[model samples]
Target chain A: AQSVTQPDIHITVSEGASLELRCNYSYGATPYLFWYVQSPGQGLQLLLKYFSGDTLVQGIKGFEAEFKRSQSSFNLRKPSVHWSDAAEYFCALGYQKVTFGIGTKLQVIP
Target chain B: DTAVSQTPKYLVTQMGNDKSIKCEQNLGHDTMYWYKQDSKKFLKIMFSYNNKELIINETVPNRFSPKSPDKAHLNLHINSLELGDSAVYFCASSPPGAGGTEAFFGQGTRLTVV
Candidate 1:
């Protein structure tokens, strides 16, 4: 079965520190991958996506993800973490009906 | 203007009661979907409609039925709701494509079954 996994359930980072969230996917073919962020009591927002070309894709809010075919991973990264970046991040895969991961909660400290 | 919108931002109802959640998208997308987010914050796709046609239906209970009156609107009706049904429901829409178009989400409706 095709599935997306975010190994880290919860991560804490200090403000202004670099952040990286790991994501691994299992699919038969080259699948469409995405990253979504959900703040507390709010709807989800698309962060970035990968489809065909250019393994590295840049998205809104200074977020970027690289699709590594060999590793079967599409990990999200940010140069410097912001206090407002603390939220729930979900890695998803699909075209019509997307399947989301269990999500990783990020806690930013001062 | 909101691209995708869902009515009843918060719903608190008693178990065994039937309720409906309505959704509409103005982005002129052909595909729309409904997803359920559990208390643990896990999201699962429930149903999907493409141009007013039922396309994808997950292994959800029969008590849950989705109606798409038109291409722009899709409504979900739950019969005899149970306590386990309490969770946040989100409505989303995306354009037709083979390259995986991005989805626009609504400000989910939080349903609490008491």
Candidate 2:
């Protein structure tokens, strides 16, 4: 049984401000982690994924995440958020189970 | 070409009617999946087919039947649709081998039951 937890339901940040979204997971086997972004009425787009190797991974739209094995955390970060960056973000864990977090709704203020 | 596509981008029908949503992947992938996104925007996997073999099937009602004519197409048929069934359904495709392989998603079909 695999599960993902995203503590924040909604997060608001100003344009050009840094942002970090927290995600935690519970999985027995080696976890396959992913971060996805969903815009209004659009399909989810992959931001980044962590399979193995370097814990720090970079993704599209200036997003990055670090996989912490001890803490079971894979947090997504962006140095500076753009207005268009506001959307729903989901964190997923495992390959077989593939449980997704409740999702964090990001709001970027101009 | 679209990697994954679903027909009837919008479906509106009355309760108790039967409707079907078709999905196809031109990506030549070996795996296809059906997911539902409810009004709360929570995405849940309903079924997964790998190479036309049913690999995963959630606790969906028998009214929801999925048929994979081949590896490239997986269609979902629903019977006795109810208002609670209104949601956006997405179809995704991916190749077999590893799990982390990115699953390409279709534009999604929004089903509304009146």
Instruction: List DockQ, one per candidate, in order.
Output: 0.90, 0.56
lDDT of 1 by residue, B51-92 (tens): 999999999999999999998998999999999999999999
Writing each residue's lDDT as its tens digit, candidate 2 over A1-110 gives 78899999999999999999999999887889999999888888889999999999999999999999999999999999999999999998767435678899999999
RMSD values, in order shown: 0.7, 1.0
DockQ metric, candidate 1? 0.90
Best-performing candidate as measured by lDDT: 1
Q: In candidate 1, residue B34 scores what lDDT?
A: 96
Clashing pairs in 1: none
lDDT (C-alpha) at residue B111 in model 1: 95
Docking quality level of the chain pair in candidate 2: medium
Q: Residues B35-77, candidate 2: write the lDDT tens digits.
A: 9999877888899999999999999999999999999999999
Question: What DockQ was computed for model 2?
Answer: 0.56
